[model samples]
Target: MTVNVLVPSSLSREAEDKREATRKLGYVARAATIFRADRLIVYPDRDGETGRFDDGFVSTVLRYAATPPYLRNEAWGMRDELEYVGVLPPLRAVSQTGSESNGSGSTRQGIVTEVGPEGRVRVNCGLQHPISLNTPPSMEVAEGERVTVRISSRRPVRAKLVDGPLPGLSVERTDLSTALGREDAGVCIASSRHGAELTVGRLETLAGRVDRDGMTVAFGAPERGLPEILGIEASDVVAAYDAADVDDRVDVEPTDLGFDLWLNTVPNQGSKVVRTEEALFATLAPLSLQE
Candidate 1:
């Protein structure tokens, strides 16, 4: 097999472009005074609330802002309290790998509660909030597949696979009825400009939201009081073979409204094209700002 390599020009251009994008993002967020150069950047929030310099806004913009499954940490999507939502007590979700949790007398095998939008399925052996999987095992459980779920307090109870026979871990089932209750991926309208999702590579790479539900984000919205305002545009992505990183160099694609971004630095681990605009923006808040 033959493999093509990245030319020096391409590599340098990508590096410089990435650097400029990140720098611009920092200036827009931290700079007390806005400048003409910023008009071209993809500011996560347009409310003109300017957050901080050494803060997370800058990182979020230049990095993962749209990626999925990660927590939203904002209040806009926090629909209700843990109790009001009628969640069963934290039941431990165990996997067939003997991965049982303690205090988890929560490990109970039960019928699926209900499956909702996307790949979400809700099982109720009487538990509150879904016991999120650190790596949600494949949702191979059939509607009637005997399964065991481990319950845990202080955290969402996880459901494990038991008595059922299946393949690998993936929630993609044409028979939507296979899994329990599930919610559609949450998206923050505020961060939509960076595209539907941003890949930060690690959990700590991005800032945590004040209220993490499932979807919806605040960006710089909390500073203003309209925590969950709507009316943002979203774009469909062409998934590229690569992803951009904090310092990745790569190519840019244009979309009808928002543009597409691609990164090649993290070779092979390459990802599909991502939807982004302006390539970068200043998310930095002034160093004096508090969290």
Candidate 2:
């Protein structure tokens, strides 16, 4: 199933400095990686953005974080937003063969270094050297584009460019409504403390639905919850959830954000506020369970 994870551009609003902000986004990346999210979308929250770290900074760091370590230097040469990228945590996502394999071979993320004659391209995919591969008959690729390479063996470096989804996370920037309206956006959920408390019974039902339909989960900024970011009242979210509990068919028109559910993954908390990164772990831990 496709799992899409969305976070606001102002996710680092509570961070004190660039280092702290970069570090904070690291955990967000970590959460997505751990949960095997297909996409990491950064939705705009201009009003909540603060300091020098805006949407561009957030997207840049996230994209950089998602890049494989070996290709990072060539993928993103030098950028102002990555000045403090040293503080970002290592994702160590499974990008190569060994534990993870596909069919007869293994799929890995690769960057096209050069496009040669006869529809062949040289790709750098963490191999000893860049390997020349023929582009798939139906696919067209250009230099600097990222592609997936299926490797059958590494001793002689036998690999081929295949039209397949890249392993690990992919970063993109878009508005919230557009993300929620995507065809693969399954059961869209908005995370908020003021929403319905996720009970065991509710989780079981939610899990089943998510497993069948896939899911697109959206999160807010550090201090700004979904209600504030979406320009809705917290009470309205609570009321919508309460109404849904009574009747599952009840449409949550009060929020008008198009989310199927406004969920409080962490019901009772000891802290006054839960950081967005922390909330990711708490929320995804249960939602990503396999049946």
Candidate 3:
């Protein structure tokens, strides 16, 4: 099943400086990678965004964090591609294709540019040239689709389209409504302190839905929770999210947009507040659990 995690553009709004902001975003990226999220979307929270946090800074840092160390220079060589300058931890992505055999080959994320006759497809696998590779008889690919291509050799361009996960998570910057409305967005969940407390039984049921239809989990920015970001009061959020019951979609419209569920992933907290990164791990832990 596909899993998408959403973080607000003001994710680092609570940071005191750029160094702290970059560090905070690094943890967010780590959480997404650890959860095996297919996509990490940066939704706009313009009103809640602080002056220190730039509009596209969050996405830029995340994109940088997701890139492999070796490929970062090649993929993000341009000056504009580099955003935050703080040190970032390495995200050693686990390749779906088995481990490299003596370093002769490596897995690379690619985009399909053209699907030609006789199962030949042109793919841009970060190489100097977009190479044409043959697809497996059972596999079907379309132009403009992102894919994982295993390149055994670069000189002669020997590669094949393999069935596996992308080397690293992909990043996207978009608005909340637009992201949730995507065709593959599946079940969209909003996490907030004012939402219903997630119990064991409720989590088990939710996990089933996530496995079946895939899932998109959205997180709020620092200090400002989703309720505030969406211009909904905390009291109304509690009433709307809780009273909506266990229906596939929450009927009460807390904000202009709708979500399948508004969940309080952290229930009885000793601390008065739970940070976004903490919430991400706490929320995804039970939700991503296997039966």
Please list the C-alpha lDDT of all candidates, in the order they appear. Answer: 0.27, 0.85, 0.76
Ranking, TM-score, top scorer first: 2, 3, 1
RMSD of each: 21.6, 2.3, 5.7
For this target, which candidate reaches the highest lDDT against the unseen true structure? Answer: 2
Using TM-score as the measure, the top candidate is 2
Model 2, 1-291: lDDT tens digits are 889999999998888889999999999999999898999999999999986789999999999999888789999998889898888888888664346643358888899999999998999998889999999899999889999988888776789988978877989999999999999988888888988888776777777677877889999987889899989888888777765562343233323557888899898998999999999999888988856
Per-residue CA lDDT of model 3 for 134-207, tens digit only, reads: 88876778886667777787667678888776667889998888888877777778888778888876776676
Write one digit per residue (lDDT tens) for candidate 1, span 36-126.
1111122223333232222233334322221111122321144221112121111111221134424554344444444555554554333
lDDT of 2 at 43: 96
- TM-score on alpha carbons, each prediction: 0.20, 0.93, 0.77
Compared with the true structure, the alpha-carbon lDDT of candidate 2 equals 0.85
Better of 1 and 2 by lDDT: 2
List candidate 2 segments past 4 Å from native. Answer: 96-98, 101-104, 246-255
